[model samples]
Target: MEAFERARLNAYFARLAAQFTTPERPAAFLITHLLPERPAFVRAVATQTDLRAVLPKPKSIHAAARREVERVTQCDPLSRDLFENDETALDYIEARAADTPLVLLDVGGYFAPVLDALCDRFSGRILGVVEDTENGHKRYADCDKLPCPVVSVARSPLKDPEDFLVGQSVVFSTEALMRGRGDIMHGRPALVIGFGKLGSSIARLLHAKGVQVTVHDIDPVRRTQALAQGFTVARDREAALTGAGLVLCATGAVSLRGDDFPHLRNGAYIATVTSSEDELDLGGLPDVYTRTPDGDHVTRYQTTGHYFYLLNGGNAVNFLHGASVGPFIYLVQAEILAGVRMLARGDLGSGMHDVGADDRAFIAATWLNYFNR
Candidate 1:
């Protein structure tokens, strides 16, 4: 079997290459989590054009995926073309001049600093950047101006289905995590922080699994929505945290912190669904509690009568199982690929935009055709 042979299993990639990629496209830069699908996406992009490099998300980049990507892109074993983090990728890309536009495809806004630099310093055409996560979009949202238009699939309707499935994956992985530890999470009191798109789905899945689920969101509207859906919303956060046997952080922005650590129920198991360690602030944990390592990916934080288990440290727990999003990841990946095509037109100007309706239709139709066939 060849490197991209795995990629060919999903017809979507070849189709994506046909529709969005062309030989004339500018050099592509990819900022992504190197899951099993990454090499597949890379192979697809490489099919019709060339890539400048592939930069893996610093923490979550899998070793196997890296090797496969190196193989798929045919990078010399010692080549500097593959990068492991933002800082390194930036160092390489910032040296270019504005002679030609650079195409960016990023996840979690990993290349925000590069984009910001392009706005003024680099003087190159950042043809555009395609952002895949909501928090990633937020990183670019604050800037009043940009060097090039950014097309975001993070907020598009195309992403809604994936959001629901991501919640399912997170809960399913949480359940799997427990089962691996010779335990089950059913009937346990679970507290889910954040009730937005992903949070709401995680809460509901936990509830359906027979776990007594409580939800907390900073937004009053979200809290009310949880209540309307028959989930518990405690009068205060401390109370909710103190009762949960399983605490899951869904809000990509604010999930947990060291100060909130003491509030967790004794013997509780906690996890998060964010891409990075930002979801749960771990720097505060040691100051508040004595820690004990509980084998792989498990840390026990406790003092006196208080104790809780933090799973996978503080990163997305589902990823521990590999290809965590399964085939459904294609939905978001496909939209992101389309964003690359749109930016090539050089018409969106210097602002953030969504994948247009026509593009969405093509993606949806292609997706249905792939599945139905």
Candidate 2:
């Protein structure tokens, strides 16, 4: 290993040990690296002590990973994106939104500019907007000022439904998977595995796109709800992988079994919207990996391999990229953006699926403008 790489690895493990000793295991984290190259062995190392290990060295992975991890763990960055070029960010966001009205499940605070712009341009035309938080009900109740309505189990839905639709209210969930982290919802072939708040929203959007959707969660009730929403429901994780162009693991569970992905066909993609990449053992797969802007360090186990392509190593797909527009703001952006997509596609009129490209671009642009402003 290079001198800097060795030093970085040492520092990373040391930090992990320190964190293990703390009363709280960081539920989520954003690791930034100053190293120029990604270490070949970018894998999750969780000891029996529960210390999560990551080499937040300088590289493409760390740079893009900052926003998602920081939001959930409440861990602040050592520095800020002081020199972030809005133009480039805008271009990137626009490009991603160009041809697709993606149903994004913004988890654990993964919202960025691209999402915001999509909403601003195509208000009321996006697909379903859903959010999951520790105190989803309370979060929605406390929302006095926001672009959308807050939806929560604790509150009465008889009130203005539109308020929550725009995220005037927010949902807070205290699930271990979230561990107080947040995420963003973008891209395509999105299949959020769990049918909790996050999974439902993703399913709703994808369904609108006329995309075949499937949802698998431990809860049979959620699976039933997904089925009602015109989504294919899989009772088993492995069953969910069948005919899925993309597999989005959002169960927030640790350690995904290899058998769950046995049928992952050639060119199939799997994005992780969870907490760690350690869940899936990609070494068993037969695909190559790729990296995203969010530092997910994706290893695509192509069909040539025995496994599947792992997006963000099954970590929070949002965290695999970059920047927090702040926690609540991030979720709000996600909700609105997805809502806008629904509106643009006329999905809401039928109370079903629809997503539009213009709306997608608008949300991305608006959020980008909001973040930099």
Candidate 3:
């Protein structure tokens, strides 16, 4: 009946003053927020105590999420500096532009300025070809069915790369967000599962840092890419789980509710950049720890459930919350281009990795210099 009443459902909030801060309160709110599209929990909480007055409108919740996303993008000190009017990001994209017969696929809340920035940066080198997919094209198409180049990758890739480039924004955003926060990501192994795009990016980053990375993906191309990137890719999920010091799932595929942790080693860290609504089978895993974003959803692991982890439990770390695709693109471009440049100069020796951290740091600092300029 009362909003704080729902908060009573959570043991973690036993000492709460108002009880609205409990996981139960937010969980109830999330349930009400979805499907029925109403804030039943908010209203209930409001009716019970002074908390009602503070309840944000349903539309405001969505607006808040958007605002949070935008604010994060603008203020990400590490990434913003790297991408603020980035020259290298532009240049790298331009080089790719010349390589016609490419496809660009954008998904999970991608925007046009990013696309336009890429296109404008590429300019003449950009073969008059770009394609958008999912929400990317629908949001950016013009009357002429063309994107503003600076604004959209508004169509699927045609047969020719010169005609369309399927942009991948989701993957870009995850990496960007993580880089912005900090280079180091720590979590339990079972908490991290699924070797999707986001998974591979994080793994590559860790691998570059000399951390052992174990990845599982059904796609052979993905496995090959991981292997090529100097990561240990696994065809069998069980095999991949071995020696997983830290794991994070980037897989988008949904599964039934419960725990599905592959036998985890002690103190292994795990996180997922996947959706949160669709539960993973986590019931059988070690009950040692559970964490979820904002604490609404949780994956048990670690010592204190109170420590609330961000990547597990149905919701994805990359798509649903946090990170910006624009910055991700900028960083990825910076890394790739630097690699290309080094190779062009005959500086890199045999079996050279894609882009080294020193180069990426230089790129970031270079962007920071420009940002200050």
Candidate 4:
């Protein structure tokens, strides 16, 4: 939170706020993972339009953070329902749509079911959906039809900075954890699964750090991209996992499972960058895995002859162990805010669309100017 960074973020928020000029402000239901800048984003949205309900990702926000959100938004305490489960969340959204034309702002595809339900219940009343994560974009891609347009900020080229930050944080935190355990990352062979933005960055960072990095991706194009980038591309999952000291899952899709356990080298460290639990097969671990109070967030599983170390209980190791990617998340948050406004204007079509280049350029220019200043 340097002064320059703060000023730059304010500029981005201001630009996002400018996109909404309609006299009749639409009611918006936002479902997002609770992050440090969440309250500020919520306040920004409220200033432009009505914030009907906020359904934060379950277990993402703690009590103290929840209190801060309450104080900032002045939202009804009961309305802050965790949306504990998907069924409950969809029901709430359906109930709220009965009152007005609603806009949906999502971080991940947390509201996919709600959107499906609304297709029949409320139809064209949904202004649009602003989705902020790659996984969410993938979910939207699968839908045969959507009730309204979806502006996805996750795939924006403007997110390169944020992706770099995420990669740096993940590597930094992983190295710190290893160092604390008397292990060094240098010279160790590491396997990075998935060659998407986050994964590619992670692989490059790890390679730059002197770790022997191999990349594996199911997509031929992504694998070719990794090969072109000069990293060793694994022929298959087993080829990647065999003899690797560290394994990092970056594929948003579930790439590993219990059946793949036999391929892991003895005492290998496994971590995931994906937000969901399905990426790594935690269920495949023995029921008696040990958890120590040490801050590394390690869960140990001892099988027939091998031992496995799972980071952050197979959750996104970067966010859980690395302080949630620090302040760089604001860049993505800013894009999400802009996407919300763009969606509010109702100019996009019924399918998933990238955030316009003009919007991306504005954010990048604002950031660059601030950095140069």
- The candidate with the higher TM-score, 3 or 4, is 4
> Cα deviation of 120 in candidate 3 (Å)?
42
Query: Predicted candidate 2: what Cα RMSD to the true structure?
Result: 21.0
Best by TM-score: 1
Q: lDDT per prediction?
A: 0.76, 0.39, 0.35, 0.71
For model 3, residues 1-373, the per-residue Cα lDDT tens digits are 2454334322111222132122111110001111111222223332222220121212113544334333322211112222235475465444433433222222322223344455455453221222222222333443233333211222211111211111123333433444454534444233234444335546645544455566666678777876787666665655555455455655544432333343445434345543333225555434545443333233335543223223434344433342233222323323322322332233332221334456556655553443233
* Order by TM-score, highest first: 1, 4, 2, 3
Tens digit of per-residue lDDT, candidate 1, span 1-373 = 2555454445777887788874467767777778766777777766644576677766567778789898765322212232334455455666432346678787765566556655454445678788998877877786667767888888888788889988888888777777767779976799999888899989888888888989998889998999999999978899998888999998777688768888887788998888435587788667778888875777788888888888877778877776365556777888877888788777787888888798789888887777545
lDDT, candidate 4, 199-304, per-residue tens: 9999999998999999988899998999999999887678678769899888877878877767888778877776545477656455634444344677667756
After superposing candidate 3, which stretches have Cα over 4 Å from the reference?
1-196, 255-259, 282-299, 302-314, 318-321, 327-373
| Candidate 2 lDDT tens digits, 37-122 | 22211222122112122324222245434443333222222211311334543343343333333233322222222334444553
Off by over 4 Å in 1: 1-11, 74-90, 95-99
Q: What is the TM-score of each candidate against the true structure?
A: 0.88, 0.38, 0.36, 0.87
- Can you list the residue pairs that collide in candidate 1? none
Question: Candidates 1 and 2: which is better by lDDT?
Answer: 1
TM-score of 4: 0.87
TM-score of 3: 0.36
Clashing pairs in 4: none
